[model samples]
Target: MGGFFTPDPPPPSPPPPPVIVTDPEAEAAQARQDAIARNRRGLAGTIATSETGLLQPSQGVGKSLLGE
Candidate 1:
C-alpha cells in the first residue's frame, strides 16, 4: 500500500517587489544626446555618398535651370 501512494511538495513563493524613480532632467539630457548622434550619422552618410559621386539627376529631368 505505501508503494502505491506518494506525497507532492507545495509550490514556490512569488518574487520580491521592484523600486521605481523618475528624473525629468536626466531624461531630457539623454534625449538631446540621442538627437546629436542621429544628426552626426546622417551627415556622415551624406558626405560619403557625395564623395563616391553616387548622387545623380534623374533622366529627362533637366539640363539647365530653365530646362533649355
Candidate 2:
C-alpha cells in the first residue's frame, strides 16, 4: 500500500547547486591584474584568424586565433 503512495522517490533531488565563496579582496586584486594584462596585447603586429584559408589538404599551418 505504501509503495503505491510513494511515487518514485521524488526524482533524486537534482544534484545540489554549486557552492562558491568568493573573496572581495582577492576578486579585486584579480581584476586589477587582468586590467594590467589587458594593456599588453599580443600579435598586434600581424592579423590572425582561425581559418586555414586553404581548400586542399596540403596548406599552411593553422594558427589559433585566441592562442588557446
Candidate 3:
C-alpha cells in the first residue's frame, strides 16, 4: 500500500550554490573614488562648522586680544 510499503520519496536535492564574480581593478577604483568623496565631505563639514560659528553671536566678539 502507498501508506505502509512505499518508501518515502527522497528529499528534494538542495538548490545549487550561487556564483559571484568581481573585478579587482574596478573595485579598487571605486574604493579610491569613495575615499576622495569622503575627504571632500569632511573638508566641507569643517568649513560649514566654521561659517556657522562665525555667524553666531559670542561674548568674545568685542574683547581685545590683550584682554583689555
Top-scoring candidate (TM-score): 3
- Return the clash pairs for model 2, or none: none
Q: Count the backbone clashes (under 3 Å) in each candidate.
A: 0, 0, 0
Residues 1-68, candidate 1: write the lDDT tens digits: 13446655566888887776869999999999998888887855656556435456546544646655
Compare the candidates by lDDT and give the number of the best one.
Answer: 3
Off by over 4 Å in 2: 1-9, 42-68
Q: How many Å off is the CA of 19 in candidate 2?
A: 3.0
TM-score head-to-head 1 vs 3, winner: 3
Q: TM-score, each model?
A: 0.43, 0.42, 0.50
TM for candidate 1 is 0.43
Ranking of all candidate structures by their TM-score, best first: 3, 1, 2
TM-score, candidate number 3: 0.50
By lDDT, the better pick of 2 and 3 is 3
lDDT for position 34 in model 3? 94
Q: Model 1: which ten-residue window has the lowest total lDDT?
A: 1-10
What's the lDDT for candidate 2? Answer: 0.64
Worst 10 residues of 2 by lDDT: 45-54
